[model samples]
Target: MNFTLHQLQVFLKVSETKSITKAAEELFLTQPAVSIQLKNFQDQFDIPLTEVVGRQLYVTDFGQEIAFAAQAIIDQVNAINYKLAAYKGQLSGRLKIASVSTGKYVIPFFLSGFLRGNPQIELKLDVTNKAQVVRSLVDNEIDFALVSILPDKVPVHAVPLMENRLVLVAGRDFQPPLGVSGIEIFQYITLIYRESGSGTRLAMEGFLNDHKVPIKKMLVLTSNEAVKQAVMAGLGCSIMPVIGIKNELKQGDLKVIEVKGLPICTYWNLIYLKSKRLSPVAEAFLSYLDREKNTVIEQNFQ
Candidate 1:
């Protein structure tokens, strides 16, 4: 079987995106042209690479194996080009990354510094919840992830950046129960929660479970911004990462509820796959993060 470099590149993009249309858009090719290339690749190998499941496309195990090999080849080719370009003293490339919601607020500061220093580097950022961030990292869909929760069996190298303190917040209109403990405060007020599989939600649940707080009436919402909006609207109170609500708290739009034995703190980590090689741009960004980690956190959270 014979395939061109363009075919390999297209296949890798499609595998990463899991959507033909999206891949086509990214590659600047029409849907039919992308489909024809994929069909030719499949026919040459006499194997099905992707299957449509519901409205989404999924790469088969065999397809993933091929895609992985293709990605390695592509990375090597790009590395060669980068080295060649380095001989002329130029650093330029695209960097793709994923991050949890809270990191959306802090990571940009470091990235901005890096971008200012290297204007030639293009950065693509995908900000989602913790679960999606982890998923994207594991699937090799993203180069690195900035997240608050570290999975038990992470197949990646993670560097703890800072502790993400979860604070119980409420609208300024709401009052904390007087002389009551953290556990008791839950009994007096309705709780607004982050959606399932969210790191914030998991941390809050673990804390509640540890304290033996029964959760009966709870409102689940997605995204930290949404949670802050709900709390500001006086819908209910929530426990979220301090970085997410720092502005609200400072502006008096929201207030931090002081509860005994509360403020669940977890570490935020800069995670990347152990086996995958980092591109020069990615390495430079990581170095910038390592250097400015403390300063960024202090300025953002304090």
Candidate 2:
């Protein structure tokens, strides 16, 4: 059976996303185009590569094996391209990074200079929840994982990027009930929190448990931005990183409340497994960080 490289790429994407529409969006192609290519690719095989049921797509067991081979071919093609770029005295390769959702605000600053300098480099930055980020890091699918709270039982090296300061924030016009301070404020107000798997939620839980703040009424949101919006809408107050809410604070949409022992601090760390090997692109990025991170920190976070 013969298939074009584009077919393999399309099949790989479809396998990853499990949705023709999403694969089309990522590939910048029309839905009909993706569907046509996918059908063309599947025609090469006798057995079904994919199955549709109740508006859901599922890859057949045989399709998973084909996808594995397809990924290998794609990697080989990428390696050849990188080698050719090197022959031309140009740095070019794919650099994949996974960052927790809240880390979206921080990763770009560290990457902007390096990415701008290496114009040929392809950067895949996946902004996702902490659990997915950690899973990708553990599976060796990503070159780096940006997070504030490190995963347990994972032996990884962490390079501290910046301090993550989490503060208690409410709408600008929000006022705590009289005599509410410290743990008492939590009792008086509905507390907002990120989902359970989030690094921010883990940190917030640790702080609250350590301080023995009994959260009575709680509202859970899926992301930091959601929690911020909820707080701004006067739904509840939340513990949020200053990095994410800086603009709202400046715009007077939100205000931080001074609670004793509040403003929990942790360092945002760029982490990688100790046993994992770094690619040339990854090595170059690490060197660049070592050389210029101080200036980046001072200019951005400081």
Candidate 3:
């Protein structure tokens, strides 16, 4: 039996979303059109690739296997197209990068110039916590990882992009007591913290331990935005990257609390494993960074 690449693509999307309607929306096709293509693709295979039960679609175990193979085939085809474009002197390829959640403020500025210069490049950026970002890098799921704290466990090369400063901040209404200094100030207010394995959490903890600060109350949140909102709501003060809180600080919604040895500083690093081979697109990005990082940082971040 013969099946076309378009059919394979439809089936793969169907398997991923487990709903013809959703697959069609993502693929920019009508539901009936996608359903008909899926049916045609299934007809060629003796074994069922998908099944429906309880009014919901599910990819069978075999269907999952086929979806994996389909993904590889699609990737290869895209690579061939990119290579062909390169032969015509146009740089084109997919560049995948995984970054910690707070890195949102940093990575995009660095990417803007490169992406503009290479109009044909497809960029896949995954903004997650440090643990997941590191996992993606170690598993070879991405070409690069953006982080502020280096993963000591991984053997990798790091390119320091810019300074990342974390400051302890409270809502606009917070007022310090008559005479409190250094770590003693922590006793006056609750602390908002990120979840375990977050780079921000790690750095906050390191600072607390180094100063032997005693926390009276603590609240754990899963994301930077959530923590920022919680702090803005006056739930508690949190140590957060200055870059992430620029708007809040400018609007007078948040205020940085001055204490001795505050504003923990770290370098935002673009890292990749030492053993992984760099793609042409990745190499080009490195060269671009070398040439433009300083200008980009000065223009946008300063």
Q: Which candidate leads the pack in TM-score? A: 2
Q: Please, what are the lDDT tens digits per residue for candidate 3 over residues 169-207?
A: 999988877787567889988999999989999999999
After superposition on all C-alphas, the RMSD of every candidate to the true structure, in Å, is 5.4, 1.9, 3.2
- Positional deviation of residue 264's Cα in model 1 after best superposition, in angstroms: 0.9
Query: Candidate 2: lDDT of 288?
Result: 89
TM-score for candidate 2, residues paired by index: 0.92
Ranking by TM-score: 2, 3, 1
Q: Residue 209 deviation, candidate 1, in Å? A: 0.7
Q: Estimate each model's TM-score.
A: 0.71, 0.92, 0.87
Q: Point out the higher-scoring one by TM-score: 1 or 3.
A: 3
Off by over 4 Å in 3: 1-58, 177-181
- Model 2, runs deviating above 4 Å: none
Cα lDDT of all candidates, in order?
0.84, 0.93, 0.93
TM-score computed on alpha carbons, candidate 1: 0.71
Evaluated against the true structure, the overall lDDT of model 2 is 0.93
Q: lDDT, candidate 2, residue 106?
A: 97
Q: 1-302, model 2: which lDDT tens digit per residue?
A: 88999999999999999999999999999999999999999998999999999999999999999999999999999889888988999888999999999999999999999999988788999999999999999999999999999889999999888899999999988988877776688888899999979998998899999988888899999988889989999999999999999999999999998888778999999999999899889999999899889999899886
lDDT per residue as tens, model 1, 1-302: 79888899999999999989999999899999999999888888767899998888999999999999999998888777767667778777778889887788767876777788876676779888888888898888888898787876878888887778888888989976677756678887779998887888999989898888876568988878888899999988889888777778789999887776678989878889998899888888888887877787677555
